[model samples]
Target: MKSNYFFRSIHAMRGLASFAVLISHSLTLYPFFEFRAAAAGVDIFFVISGIVMCLAIEEDTSKLDFIKKRIIRVVPLYWIATGLSVAYIYARYPHMSHSWDWIIRSFLFLPQQPGVDMPILYTGWSLNYEMFFYLILFLSLFIFKNAPIAAACIVAMIASFSAVGNLISYNYFFKQIFIEFSLGILIGYFLKFGGRVEKNLGIFLIFLALVIFFIHNKFASSGFLAWGVPSAMLILGAISFENSELFKRNFVKIFGDASYSLYLVHPLVIWGIEWYVLPEHRGILQVAIAIAISIFISIIFYKWVEKPLMRFLSKNL
Candidate 1:
């Protein structure tokens, strides 16, 4: 089956975001240099999710059909990753106790309450926000026919709720991140209604550089601005440079195809390395080794697990 050029472009962007996160984590593990800017990768992913989900819904399809397709796309791989991570945690830390309710909440992708130990797959926390975004988007479709209006409303509601939730309680990770996903929806609306962003090579390069500088300076100081500003700029860059040669290589496309798997599985690989290989090592060399191991493991997981699942879903579902 052939995918559209637009979808392929989104896939390529996902790959870039995943690699950015990898670099960020590696730098964080070391002492001398810190590149917290990498965390903006998740913000980019959320935006891409919003754009792609809206695009998918633009086709003539019933709500049930839309829900089914999403479930098939997200649930199978998510559950597999969750289950493995939980088992790994249990095996590694046999004395660590967790409640059955916490397990249930994580598995169900429900909003985790404060003081609960997050799931073993630390990155799985993002999936909860993604599921929440889906729920909001699904409900909005019934109340509003205009996709852009619906997306804008969703973004505003999430932002308002996030601000209130943060004020009430200090711990609001889920609420805060959900806003990033909604921002993506707003971007999608812009893409649909505002027409293509005009591309000027020089201006695009300048915007990209400014985005990097902004993310690097702000990520360590301000969590909200770190992801929010750079994510917006990244999406704008992506849409404007859709046909650019910067990301049109075969290897890049392959990485993009496997990015979801890499994102879901890399934490486990990192944890395993920390547990067995580098428990005492905090050197830059150890950081490089950790990153290399993660990339190797993620590549295998992507090729064997993620690619096959997506292919099966596309063909059978």
Candidate 2:
């Protein structure tokens, strides 16, 4: 398929989203620096997932093939990151108690006990929601051919889960957060078939998104209301402005391609910096340097490990 301006914008946004999360997580190293606002990165990711699913589904491909492709795209890199986390855990706390069941559940991305809902690699929690969304999307294809209808079903299911979330399993998929994914799917459908808006309106939406992002960071509202709405606004605005010159940059697109690698490997980079490189120096400058290194390393990983493995698997499997 030909790459459109919207897809290009989406690609660039992926890198921005990954960096946002990296900044937010850096708060762990420098608590004095307020980076909590960047946590909205996760919300951006959920929305992207929804939109990409709509864009990517091909009637020519079998549902099983689609599912397999999704798994191969995400799981291998995720497993490597999880392995790193496990090795770190073993080295850091040799006597730390860990359950075999939890480890299995972590590796499989299954929901475990509340306290340990996250995997050995805590970031894998997001992947659980991702996989769940993929499963639901895959199955929904059998029942609904229209992407919009399937998206609506996903929204309704998440809404129902949210209403009864307190009574049901506290798995990540059941949380209100999953609604972000549904919103993204709806947005995807809009991009595919929705009417065009005036460019001024697109600019307004972008401004609105920024305003909401800043406000949410300062006030700290519910994740869905705060980051979710802003993320949707950003995507909608970006789509609306897809034909603009702003979407034509190659650097952003390259970063977007490396976004997954950046997201997955960043934590390890942070860990190394914090635990070994400069344990005593977590000042803003150190954090900045660490973030720089993480980005550089992630680009390398993307260029080498991620790209090569994906190509190999796509060709062979």
Runs off by more than 4 Å, candidate 1: 1-8, 165-176, 205-219, 313-317
- Candidate 2, residues 111-179, lDDT tens digits: the string is 887776578887788888888888888777787767435755766577556666366656356567788
Note each model's CA RMSD in angstroms: 3.0, 2.2
Q: In lDDT terms, which candidate is top?
A: 2
Clash list (residue pairs), candidate 2: none
TM-score of each: 0.86, 0.92
lDDT of 1 by residue, 31-83 (tens): 45766667777887887887777656663547776676777778889889889
Weakest 10 consecutive residues, lDDT, candidate 2? 1-10
